[model samples]
Target: MQQEKESAEEINELWSLYGENRSMEIRNRLVEHYLPLVNIIAGRLAMSLPSHVDRDDLIISGYFGLMDAVDRYDIKRGNKFETYAGIRISGAMKDELRSRDWISVSLRQKIRRYESAVVELEGRLGRSATDEELAERLEMSIEQVHHLERQINAATVIPLGEYMKSEAAIAVDTDPHRSAEYIETRETLAKALDELTEKEKLVVSLYYYDELTMKEISLIMHLSEARICQLHTKAMFKLRGFLANIDGI
Candidate 1:
């Protein structure tokens, strides 16, 4: 705690220095001071991404985000630099993933169709829809619905991030008024969470809120990693469906 306080103090001092001169040297120093933040964000993202995606690449992308945040941050806004930078950092990593996206058009169509059905059914029923209902709604067999979910699993990275945090564009200003939007998102999220199954809730909590990797969550829950991923997908889709029913989310 003491070290963190001192570090924050040092960052404030550096910001003051940058305010005076705004030199690349001072700005670069600020970026260097916060490079660990970039790494942390990248590492968190790496756990959910495919094995083929490089962690180093994510770190590099997150570095760009950190640089962007350092360049635009307004200390007078009363928002913590870390919170603001986190949005930027994760946005950069997600943008990188989008640029290199490998999901075929067919799979993208399936994802959209799947989510659309889920949201539509949830809105009509005014509650979380069951898998049996989803299968019937989509006119697919139970096995097909499960397969669609596995395909949707690959699409989880950033859309889940979308529900979890504000997008970079929306968060760039980071002013006080935006606090209401964040509050609404969190409150809606909490409500959706209450509707989730116990196992689904645990998976969401451990994987996201607690920031544990799939392997770690699987070990804790005494389930296979594959099963944990399914729970995560189901919970996220449910939350997304509930939030989708809300206006201006």
Candidate 2:
């Protein structure tokens, strides 16, 4: 425990120095200190790689994200570097999955339909259905049903990075002069949300706006919990893309 604390402190120090664009020594320290975090996230991602991907490749991708996080983490935020960096690193791996076409549109639509079906079934039955029951209702094999259900494990993770970074972006200032800026930011975000795909929008609504658990969401939508998870994950990846390109919001 003491060693872990010391290591985390070292990571924070490196992050601070890097954020200020300090010497190569600080950058090197940051990489060395956080390499373990990259590896940990990479290991977890490896479990989901469709049995054909190279784990070493995924680790390299995660390492890049960890390095980026170490260099870019803001000191003003109260959140720990480890907490933020972990999400970024994990998100990087997920991006790689998208590049591999693991989360295609057809699969997303299937999950959406499955969710609707489950919700309708439970509405009539008034209880959670078994895998066999769900399979029968969906006209799918039990194994197929299980696979579809597991697919929901992929979720759209909301990138809180932008929201955390620009305090003035969303915060309302008492100064009347700044009201124009607030209105512009809201418009920018609205435009970005408008550009999202249907599944992405639903994922955002169900998970963020509605604050539904993936399981409860699955029940409500009439889909397996795993499918809901996947939709949310995929949606988050797209939202991150929008956030990266949009300037103000």
Candidate 3:
């Protein structure tokens, strides 16, 4: 199947015909056209997950997501359908990952404690806490800290794209935050992003913004997939910790 995104005119023509007739064939074609996107998103997400987790299963879940996007998309929304569909696709794959969660409840608690230690130490140290510092704060060995990082990597289901979309959706739900808190939320997000090292930030941008796979990012940064995942997990840790402290996030 061709994975390339179709030109706007061609897509618009198909959409226009679909709009005129509401034909099943036209809708199927639209779904066919975007199948590569489903593969792209599912593949990228699977790279961050464990090896045993089925990539095909993620792609299966993504098919439904793509169909949902095709059905629910509004032509008048003025946003690119590909962008909207990618978010929906990623969100669906994440939901599937959540359903298949293997992390124990106690381990989740330990993760919380780990995050607390990182935040607490960072607050005291006035910078990103080193692995040594984190180990001391959590009363664990350096090796144990590395183990925790691995665990966090496996348990980290929400990538930056999914997090950003979910947070923005919550922001629009009845305007929970006033203008000032909303502004603060933006600033808080900016500050959280700034917490990452330059390499980590580039990984975030390359993966979420550019929608490149881990392999692509590794090639770009000259790092192994494991190392890239490590960077991603740590960046996410800092972002989640900081955002969790925000009022309406």
Give the top-scoring candidate (lDDT): 1
- In candidate 1, position 240 carries an lDDT of 75
Query: How well is each residue in 7-32 modelled by candidate 2, as lDDT tens digits?
Result: 66666666666767767877766667
TM-score of each: 0.76, 0.53, 0.78
Q: Candidate 3 lDDT, tens digit per residue, 29-124? A: 899988889998887787667788899999999999998888867665455778778877887887887888756798889888987887788788
- RMSD list, candidates in order: 4.8, 9.4, 4.2
Best by TM-score: 3
Candidate 3 segments whose C-alpha is farther than 4 A from its true place: 1-8, 164-187, 212-228, 245-249
Question: Looking at candidate 1, what is the lDDT of residue 210?
Answer: 79
